[model samples]
Target: MADRRSAGSRSIAIVGPYLSGKTTLLESLLSVTGATTRKGSIKEHNTIGDASAEARDRQMTVEVNSATVEYEGLRWNFLDCPGSIELAQETYNALIGVDAVVVVCEPVVDRVLNLSPLFNFLDEWEIPHLIFLNKMDRADVDFMQVLHALAAVSSRPLIPHQYPIGHGHKLKGFIDLVTEDAFQYHSGACADPIPFPEELQVEEKSARQEMLETLADFDDKLLEELLEDIPPPQDEILQDLKMELGADLIVPVFFGVAEEDYGVRPLMEALLREAPDPSATAERRGLNDADNQPIAQVLKTYYTPQGGKLSLVRVWQGQIEDGMTLNDVRVGGMYRLMGQQHQSVLRAGAGELVALARMDQVKTGDVLTAHAPAPDLPVARMIPQVYAKAIEADNRKDEVKLTSVLGKLLEEDPGLRWEQQGDTHEIVLWGQGDIHLQVALSRLQRKYNLPMTTHQPKIPYRESIRRTTSVHGRYKHQTGGHGQFGDVFLDIQPRERGAGFQFTQKIVGGVVPKQYIPGVEAGVRDYLARGPMGFPVVDIAVTLTNGSYHSVDSSEQAFKQAARIAMQEGMPRCKPVLLEPILNIKIAVPNDFTSKILRLVSGRRGQILGYDAKAAWSGWDEVVAQLPQAEMHDLIVELRSLTLGVGSFEWTYDHLQEVPERFTTQVLQAAWNTK
Candidate 1:
């Protein structure tokens, strides 16, 4: 396939659960195809996709890595996407510009269950995909059982193109039912055809017939021939597989041990011949005309040390040039993404993903289609589920530097957010979780040399009144020449929970000068802003009634002082309460772990809504719940523990509820001391 064929080369995202051999498969693909000098083992920490220090230390694919291989004159870019749901966006982002996905799964039933999330993502996106059953050598499970497990959540027919030649630990390789041949792992790089073992020949023949029957159902003529006892031609089987996959009606399953590279050759051949190319894909996005208008999407961004932010884009229409201005948009610097590095390229075409340098205002999902009338594409949205606050050195001079350092760090990761928490003088840095926040903070120190300290963020608790009462506040200072005198009477009452603070004036006789009333209200507000507890006071209504003032010496300051004193006298008597934040969370884990999960929920004072089967999960279930934000820190740790390091979740702010009495004491005490 020529680069300009435009119906871009078929791409497949190799994704699944963590430690399920996603990176190992990538290493295998690169080695068998001779893309690299030698395959780097994870144990040696030298694989391409698992390049980061943290990733190597953990022996996992933390981010998606795309690698290109030229096979049989057609270029195939396989996206080695991370299997962890925590870094799912890395997979989602890769899926955006590809033709199809190849979901890699393990042989164990529990491990196979984790494939749901990837399944759902592909199904929801209508991405034509195939499921690769990897690591056959480590399992004791039946092959059909694994197929049935996948088919349980699969809406489309999970037709198999190949089957394992043996079961469990004795499994050596696969029987390509389509080819009716046995593939043995002569080396850890590829499958080599060999004589079938006499003992398994009968089983292999039955599987080959079953696969042929599956392929027949996809074609009208073949289906008729199959029913009529006519053998379908090899060409017909290949054509039917291509049709079903292209129509997104079926997900073909390919069995392989990626670590041994047992079945990659056949998998690669299927991808090149059966998977639809870029032209068919882009057409669905309404990209047809050469002059229709230029349309591209910013899929991801990276900052270049010399040129600045690199915006990786997938152009769907009209061509981009070196200097041409499409509408008001100027041609930004163009570069080709070579793994993590970028090299300047003259131009990249429609259906091609390219990295353009230094496009600052562009973000992750910005669409640049038809410059004049932008085509409305559904926005690719990712919610940052977890959050933790990061703080700076907390020293006087370092505070200013921290602010400056954070400003630049934020440019790279929009999921990273921060707030000054102004009055408290605490710079709160928020992110998806502890690791996410720390990663940004680490970059600040290592990449930008900005040293900082951080702590688990304090909840922004607010205080309000449950009842109202009236009180008087007076301040008199008689030193000499001009004596100070001021007095105020107030009627305080409760407002709706979120209504916030409100003040009203009702002066019947102007007992206190009308000019001095403004000062009195200001004084009342000053007390409310800091509150009886050291937090913003809300849901309270105050009415200014009768008061006295010295005609000559009572200044605005004196009236303000009197009002402040009056509020201080009345607030404590009104039955003040504290409010805390509640977050709605959704945790997905294996189905077997459900009972224990609910138990853990109760321990955290959390309310579990329900347990529902989620197809996108591999060997798991998802539980939706609502828990107080204050109790969230160790929830992920507990979730992993309960599921044996297989479960994960995402959360967001739900609402606010009154803090229970047991928790209110601490809230009020902290507030009083701060006041």
Candidate 2:
């Protein structure tokens, strides 16, 4: 908890594919760092990083989590992000405040390909990072072979910082390429600093040469020294390594069987010595008001037992004092976070990540600078791909709670969304995928004790006439002194596809009075909003050719009746047809699965728009197609099932295509019965 302990401290996010021991690695790091007295197991459902019931049930990380550890006199804030692509955006958000990222990868060739998205993101953001080859104890395959596989998938140079000394369950230890020291595993637990093994001297020298050459890539002085058979100073090499790391030119690679805790100490040393600190990142990210104004960005927000809405904010400028009103915006509360338990700090300075609690309208990605109405910060945004129709609380007792829960979820994850689906009166929650929305639901249940049920959204379909017909309708009723009476004549014709609904008038003489005529058109328009087939009427033009109405009895109501009667009589003769929504889908899959993916697309009655291999990924292909949205409601499930969870797709409504004749009739019958 000392200030100096976290002086050079850097936040590092552990990201990789699913079931790659991410939770176990987090627990191990906690145990080794002395944050926890005993390391917890994922199967036992006691890991610090996975505290939610859904996570325990799944036995895998379902959301992003943050934890801090102090070791070797420096604090480390490690963010263990979920591995599955379903929660990748959460991981990317975690990457925002952190100075560097540690891409935890499995020591297998095939599984390593799954890190493409993460790798691509790191490159896009130009974030300094490293390769952490985990599960070395169980890694029966060759380490260099795995590196070769990584080289094919990774765009950055994966300079080896360490190499395993052995293999399989007998993976005794690793040889540090930088220090030329050998470390042995005691029992997949906390490691002890030890002397190098004499037998590994040959490998140590060779690996050290590779490390030296990697460092010399950006240092001409070192390159000249190496070429002239002269040795460069160790301190100079360290400086260059740190410099290049900050510039995003080098990604230090670290090898460790996290379960064994074999290489953690050295990994920590590298992080402290090489990874950029808050000061360096502050200079790069730039302070908006570096001179006179206070500026900070709220990167994360969480609830605390007594702290009350702790916002984990990174100070980009002036100090965040305990009791200061930047612009009378908020009477700032305590600055504290859960360090094992809630710990308070009076103030946090520039480049420091701290928690600000009970601040009004202070949210994730908000620019908390000096102002009453804060200038909104540009934050990360992701498109939602999955959707589900929901209903208000069945008990009608949780409406407020559900609203609060939804607000919290949207704040935490920028990818989630909720809306009142106008067509079906269903409250729908849309997001990245099923797992993403499910995790949110679990978070709602655990955080707010709210229960919710989600069903597939009702597909928005349209019905249009294929043929034209004219019909007249009349309505008359006598109740009192005044009697209601109205008549309307409609000439309906098909328009070009996607022309939607149009209304016009062709009456030269007022067969129907002017006021009554507008009412008739209004009634016709209302009917078109929801057609007889229980869908919106589209691509049809309607005209009021002739009509009759009683001056006293004619009203919007009477004209509405006439229009309704006309539609009932005219629609059946107009060749009604059911139109299904078409979706433009872009599916990414491994090249080996291309044939299967194409077959599935074809089976869905899809039209191939384009197909090409991904330039960023090896052995991967992208298939662009347009298919019926109805067929794509569960397409993600099927794609994952077919491709072993290695495929992903983004799709949205493109256009409507006519349903098959038999299906159209069935749809019409279903709508008739349901209505």
Candidate 3:
């Protein structure tokens, strides 16, 4: 029976919010499918999905995990994705290659809002998905109420496929709406069919009618039969459910306590019956030519300590076999990933998700095909980073290794970024949040054995003169052969803000030779590298109005020394000010959180430019503000906390502004200490 269903393989992703029992549900699915003899629990740190040491240490999934199973002869590959919003990009990347997504969620009503972003992405991309209301035994609300709450957040119709027989935490079983039959769950076995309870008959009938009405909206025959008071056949109803689900006309909601393995078998059956086949999914993704060369896409990339680079890919067309070359890169080996464990496979046919080892050049979301040419696969857009920190290796000897590891880390997770800031000379690592960076650091220590230290990045501050004065500079040295002598009078003046440094000379009557004039400019620039405030100087002008130089003894080097002397005497007379970097940040949040965001910006010494409705995003406001880079390190943390983890921002360097008088002392002290 399983072999009959295994005619073709299919891949699906399990996605949801954190602590939603997604991994627990995966264990149940594997157990019920007979892929494993016993189910693993998360509390015991024995689950198959969250198999990585980092995940086990944190008790959360930090990366995408894939497990393959054969149920009733059907080959099924499930991609279990991380649930934290900080790690949502992993789920999004895996989603692009799957035939469908099983959205797991808690039965809590208020928390249903947490699924808004995931649902929005699924709808926007037209990805087929279903809802699995997990932890039913712990739910405190009515099933109908939960359904309504879920419907409010989804853009499609919610069709209840089963109605729970019991209420609240004592959920005993559920009645399948299509078959009109009650089924009671066993401790660790498939549910047994049973007769409907007499007391709940009315409620069951009503739920069944609602399900039919939803399905009828998508089926004319079903609607006519219902309107004429003709009961639809069970097979006919099942067919409609399958067709509607594949078309993404409705989201079929199923209930279960995954820890107890209840409802998992039924959900698997639904997947086999209703989920679209790989051919249909491929056509939907625009990979319609099945006879073409092998085509695939990378869903995730892993750098295994033992196996090296493994590219988790979904085969979209043709077939992939060992010894074949894809995009000019040789295929070393293909294996099916069972958590961190792998099973070698000779070949992967169309629609199978397998890992191709040693494909170092393939990155997540890249398309792989034969020499003919790869199609432009649909890729998920990158989310802008909101948090960052300066990081460095604890041991200086490992600096080169640190860079190589950072490249691998970024290839596995594009959301992690690092760059060396030119001004501050700090290597900053940017990510979605604090935890995201922590995970990367953990990976660095665990996978590459590189320990790191992190801190808030230093702001690239500038120093400028507020007042000016003129002074004479002279250089004289007596040596054995000759004496070096050069003299210069410099006029220093403050330039307008944002008007960069300017150098000019007015020496005439052979006072200073033109050939030596360039040396004075270089000397002034060299001095500007470190100003009185211990920062690069800007917004000042220096002129060599008068200078004397010897024909033989005075050279460019002597004139340069003289110009440096003149600046040393003249700059102290010019009062210098410290300037802080200001970033133009656009913060997007729901309108309800606008006031709180405004207060946050104000509290951080930010200047509000203006605010308006974000383009094309209803009920959200974009607050434009100029905030000092010093305050931005933790801004995303606070913004998400105030906006229910939905707030985000994108920023760019705007300009430098004068540091307030009150902060000048502390800023200067900090700068001195760092130096």
Instruction: List where candidate 3 sits over 4 angstroms from the true fold.
Output: 1-7, 612-619
Model 2 lDDT tens row, 1-675: 354454545677778888888777777777766788987877777777877576777777776676766677765677778887777766776676778877888888878768776777787777898888888767376787888888776677767878677787777777766555566778755455567777767766776787788888788999999999897776787788788888888777777777667676677667777888776776666535446456777777666445557677767656788776654555356443323355556866665566676775766777776664555544555745554546456556888567776877777776678887677777778776678778877777777777777667776778888899999999888896887888888998888888777888887677777777767777788788777677888899889888877778878788878887888788879988878889888898878888899989999888888889977666789999998877777677788788867688887777888888877777677667656
- Which is superior by lDDT, 1 or 2? 2
RMSD (CA, Å), each prediction: 3.6, 3.1, 2.3
Measured by lDDT, the strongest candidate is 3
- Whichever of 1 and 3 has more TM-score, that candidate is 3
Ranking, lDDT, top scorer first: 3, 2, 1
Off by over 4 Å in 1: 1-8, 139-141, 167-169, 188-190, 290-293, 323-332, 393-431, 478-483, 583-601, 607-626, 636-656, 666-675
Weakest 10 consecutive residues, lDDT, candidate 1? Answer: 1-10
| Predicted structure 3, TM vs. truth | 0.95
Q: Pairs clashing in candidate 2?
A: 188-260
TM-score of each candidate structure, all chains considered together:
0.88, 0.91, 0.95
- Candidate 1 vs candidate 2: the TM-score winner is 2
Q: Model 3, 222: alpha-carbon shift in Å?
A: 3.5
